[model samples]
Target: MRSRSRTYSLTFSIYSLILFNSLALHASEYLISYRYVVKDSALYNESLSISQAMKKCSGSPQIALELQTDGNKNLKKIISQNSEKFTEYIHKLGMHVEYKDTTNKAMNKSTTIMTLQTTCFTVDFNDNFAKIAPLK
Candidate 1:
């Protein structure tokens, strides 16, 4: 009876490991990087100037807000609901935004990395955004 119980326990552990491995294999990582570029050289210079002034006054660099999600459907929902609002806000700053989406099939879970890139200044609030700092 003891031998039978040990066999059962081993079988259960093997099954659990297989299930976890399968789930991990099916998971994906998603990255949606948004590049915010000033429409023209004049606007780029103005943005740089404003960023410098703000940083001087606040004693900290400006930081752009970021959105994060765990699944494609949720990300789509968020963008659909807020695209216009985001566009208008960025437009007001004399900039245009572009998005680049990438997926990694080897990851163990769903994840999204969103980044905002600009020119001539830096405003980073997270590690992911730090990867694409503005050009100096």
Candidate 2:
């Protein structure tokens, strides 16, 4: 009976560790700031912004003005395909990205920023919050 109890406790301890690590890996708080910058395109110099880039996105959320990438995939899929490119493009447009919740915005924030704990790509376009993991 003692040995069986010990085995049960060990199993419980392992399960707890896995649960904690899973929670720690994914962060549900993030902030996106809008900004504008000047860049020279093929013909003229113009000021561009993240809102503009979003317009160009071909998904539910746009990335440019009336321009779409011609894809049925969501923003998360696009990022997972090539996060480096997407990250670079957005970064160049004077956008700020944060992964922690330290401000009032985070408290009222609804976007979920998935970290290494979850899937490879996680993005929320609307004001959607993270779903609570079901207890087993």
Candidate 3:
């Protein structure tokens, strides 16, 4: 009985660790102000005031104006395909590179972590804020 109890406790502890790590990872999926820079593009460091940012991103005249945003994607794919553009854009702007939420579907492991800089841009960082405003 003693041996069986110890084994059970060990199994429980392992499961608990897995659950905790999973929760931690999922909680990291959202961001408040995510920067998506295009280094090689001519718009680097153009300083689109929020108004200009919104205006340049506008799609249809009916929509008034909109800002461009990119949805979450696999880390490997993003790095492979957009590595050049992303790196160049940030360098040109004298800013950091664009990053993605660690828990994004594209991000597989829980160990990968990233932070959201709330003051950098305007966006709610509440838990469900991403759902409130669709990623462009």
Q: Rate the local accuracy (lDDT) of all candidates.
A: 0.38, 0.35, 0.35
Instruction: State the lDDT of candidate 1 residue by residue for 1-136, as single tens digits.
Output: 9999999999999999998875543231222334433332222212111122121111222334353323333433544455665445444445443433434685332222222433332332233222112222
Q: What lDDT is obtained when candidate 1 is compared to the true structure?
A: 0.38
**Model 1 stretches with alpha carbons more than 4 Å out:** 29-66, 69-73, 81-136
Residue ranges of candidate 2 with Cα displaced over 4 Å: 28-136
Q: If scored against the real structure, what TM-score would every candidate get?
A: 0.27, 0.26, 0.25
Mind giving the per-residue lDDT tens digits that candidate 3 earns over 1-136? 9999999999999999998886654442332233444333323332211110211121211111122224533332333355465444324434444433334566432222122233122122332212112123
* Per-model RMSD to reference: 19.0, 17.3, 19.1
Worst 10 residues of 2 by lDDT: 50-59
Better of 1 and 2 by lDDT: 1
- Output the lDDT of residue 97, model 2: 29
Clashes of each: 0, 9, 3
- Cα lDDT of candidate 2 equals 0.35
Clashing pairs in 1: none
Candidate number of the best TM-score: 1
Candidate 2 per-residue C-alpha lDDT over 1-136 given as tens digits, one digit per residue, 9 for 90 to 100: 9999999999999999988776544432222332232222122222222111221122132232111223523433433455456445445434432233334744532232322211112233333322111111
Off by over 4 Å in 3: 31-136
- For this target, which candidate reaches the highest lDDT against the unseen true structure? 1
